[model samples]
Target: MKKFGILVVVFIVCVAFLSSYANADVETEKISLNGSTSMEKMVNALKEGLEDKYPELLIEPQFTGSSAGIEAVLNGTTDIGNSSRYLKDSEKEKGLIENIVAIDAIVIVTDTQNKVNNLTTQQLIDIYTGKIRNWKEVGGEDLPIVVVGREAGSGTRSAFEEILHIEEQCQYANEVNETGPIIAKVQSIHGAIGYVSLDVIDETVKPLAIDGIQASEETIQNGQYSLQRPFVMATKDTIEKQNEEVQKLFQYIQSEDGQKIIRAVGLVPTSNKMSY
Candidate 1:
């Protein structure tokens, strides 16, 4: 009887130890990604897909613009920052690590009612800076142009201005907080014009050709669209140096399946050949 009691107690202890080990091994990983409004739908989809595969993982995403996201990662506020532009040397000097996740064509959009079908980069710069106020000046109906833009910290805004050399001179008539807001405004206000990721364009807005090239998926992929920019996943040392879970999350993002998800969100996928 004494032997049997001891054996039972040992069995219970072994079972408890095994269960504890299993729980520890199956612990959930949580990550926080912050950045571009342009990548919101894609990031959300990533969260959903990752969750479905690894129910133990949790992903929290925040949209504060690409610059803000990169800053957040540098400041240790987020595990990853979503950027529509590459990280600058200054950013890298600050210990910001970048992972190029995808490519996106900065699409020029106008109110659906507007008849303007295309614009040259120079023409876009001219129209936005209040230099060319009338649509007829650019082959459209005679109407005053209403320029809408993203806030200064936006990656989309940064890339657009960078390409046009208007980072300092382009004057915006209105600055919106998010891509959705900009899209909605452009769709409703006749003569209103703005730019956003191609995924965000809908029937309510008309996409304008750039340099006679339409900002379509094929054109963007073929590099005919000059406004194509890389989407970056960035992290500070917290993720790069110390967090195992962050490493795992980033690994999933850089995986082939992840690139497919990025493409499905209406952005171009960057080949590993490009520098991050």
Candidate 2:
């Protein structure tokens, strides 16, 4: 009877140890990613691909704006920070490394009913800076041009304004907080014109040609399209210094399989031999 009791106690201890080890393993498999609403589709696609490839791995993503995402990674709260624009000098000073995984075009969009099909670089600058207030000024109808834009700190907004040299000069009638709402607002309004990531554009809104160059993989890759920006997955430290799961995520992003996923989502992968 004494021997049996001792054997039962040993068995219980072994089971408890195994359970704790299993829980720890599961926790280690999770990789947290936060940032860039613009990169949401690409990140989600990569998340699904990674999970499918390594069933034990889990990718947790949060679609806070790009600046917030950078702050999260800087504060050690996330494994990756997705930014549609390149990191600023101030951000780079804080030890964050910019990893350009893909190039994204910031396409200007308007309502489907709008007659305007293109805008010269100067015309785009004039329109956004409040110089051209009527769509008729740019060969559209006589309706008042409603400027739709992303809120402050958005990567898409930052890139759009910077590329046009109209930062802080935009006469925005409606400032939305996310990319989806910009698309929705532009779709619903007759004179609404906005900019969004090229990957996110759908039939809901019509994309405009900038300076006679349509936003496409070829135009953006060849420098013909000037409204493009880098899709950055930022890290506080080098990939070699990150944890196993974080390292694996970055590795997969650079792999051929990952490049396919990037292209599949309408983003131009860095592997396309284009200089960033």
Candidate 3:
């Protein structure tokens, strides 16, 4: 009887140890994503979908602007960097791989109270370049145009400036940090005009048709939207080289189901392609 009791106790201990080890393994299966405030909606959607598919896995995300996110991945601090803009040639030369997951339109927004509904590409350029300062000049109210923009190191700002070919020449009256605040700032100020990712568009602000082209997923996919940029999920190396959890993430993002999530979140899905 004593021997049997001891054997039972040993068996219980072994089972408990195995159970604990299994839990630890599951707890450690996490993928950390950092970067791009503009990609918040899509990232959160992907996180929810990925976690639902693989219950044992966790996705950690931090929206610390595009530049900071890219730096975090390059320094080995994060598994993936979410960039709303294309990776620069200099960044690619440093072993960062660009995985274009989606395309997002950068909508030019103004206060809903403003009567202006369309802006030519040159008019937008003049507005940000300090050449067009009054709303009346653009067929709006007599209020002065409050040009709002994203802060430095922001992927949205980088892409917006690059697309306009007006790098470092923007005359912003207010430099907001995130997409939400930019929208709020534009909505509150009667003459404010700002740019934000299309996914975040709400009824509070009016989206102007750029050169008679409205920003939409269809327009972007069909190559009619001029103010669009790639939504990149950058990795330090190739997907095959990443750990199992990270590789799983890339695989899911490339899957048809993942494309559904992208579309659901208002981002245009891209081909399953990666560039270094």
Candidate 4:
């Protein structure tokens, strides 16, 4: 009987030791993210916070168009694709799932030299669609309007057009590839007009009012600003099912801590439970 009891104790000890070892040896998750050049600041914040909290985990992020992010998810090239627009029906059909991470408002801006503080929605549409060619036509100086726009694939363009019902061709003098470029162009060029997320608004340019409403956090939260869109995280079925690291990454993003990073970058958090 004594011998049997000693063996049982030894077996329990070995099981406990092995369990501890297994937990200690658990590998850190590594995830890759792509999409939404507009998410530059937010993604950087995410990287900093995530590394601080879980140094064991690794995350790689890339800036491409939001559509490119969705495609990356579908192609299994990325764990999470950041998108500034909602996922399309075709994307759902292709086995991609979208997780809304934040809400952002599209802000229309003009060169600081223009002195134009306000524009109605129709006036902005007319200006960008080339209906109004001169800044004087929209309560500004008598300068010809230099329309600036994002590239065709930009989620900002899609969301802006959709909100404005701007079916006309983009009548821009130039098409910039990213938000930074657009902001820079608008800042440097007098009579220039462009749009970007409210987070990117700076003193170099002036944000315009739409339909008497400003693109501000309060206005966006109240739905007074009509150009709000959901920023999403995309994942394809192949990666969701087959990639353990990808799954862990999504899980962490949906967690409370992740929402804080989302808000820190000036976008509205999707999760109310997550503290700002």
lDDT of 1 at 84: 82
Q: What are the lDDT figures for the candidates, one per model?
A: 0.82, 0.91, 0.92, 0.80
Ten residues in sequence with the least summed lDDT for candidate 4:
267-276
Error of 1 at 46 (Å): 1.0
lDDT of 2 by residue, 19-64 (tens): 9998877743899989899999999999999999888898999999
Q: What is the TM-score of each candidate against the true structure?
A: 0.85, 0.89, 0.91, 0.83
| Rank by TM-score (best first) | 3, 2, 1, 4
lDDT of 2: 0.91
Q: Report model 1's TM-score to 2 decimal places.
A: 0.85
Q: After superposition, how far is residue 22 of candidate 1 from its true place, in Å?
A: 9.0
Which has the greatest TM-score?
Answer: 3
Ranking by lDDT: 3, 2, 1, 4
User: Where does candidate 1 clash, by residue pair?
Assistant: none
> Which number leads on lDDT?
3
lDDT of 4 by residue, 1-276 (tens): 999999999999999999999988978678788999988788788788777877777878999999898888789788778888877899889887767767898888888767778888778888878899998887878899999988888888888887788845669898988999999998888888888997778788888888888876677788998879877777765334646655555556677887777766778877532222
Per-residue lDDT of model 1, residues 200-250, tens digit only: 778888888899998767887788889888788877643447476666666
Cα displacement (Å) at residue 129, model 2? 0.6
Candidate 1 Cα deviation (angstroms), residue 138: 0.8
lDDT of 3 by residue, 15-129 (tens): 9999999887766488999999999999999899999899988899999999999999999999999999999999999999999999999999999999999999999999999
Cα shift from native, residue 134, model 1 (Å): 0.2
Error of 3 at 94 (Å): 0.7
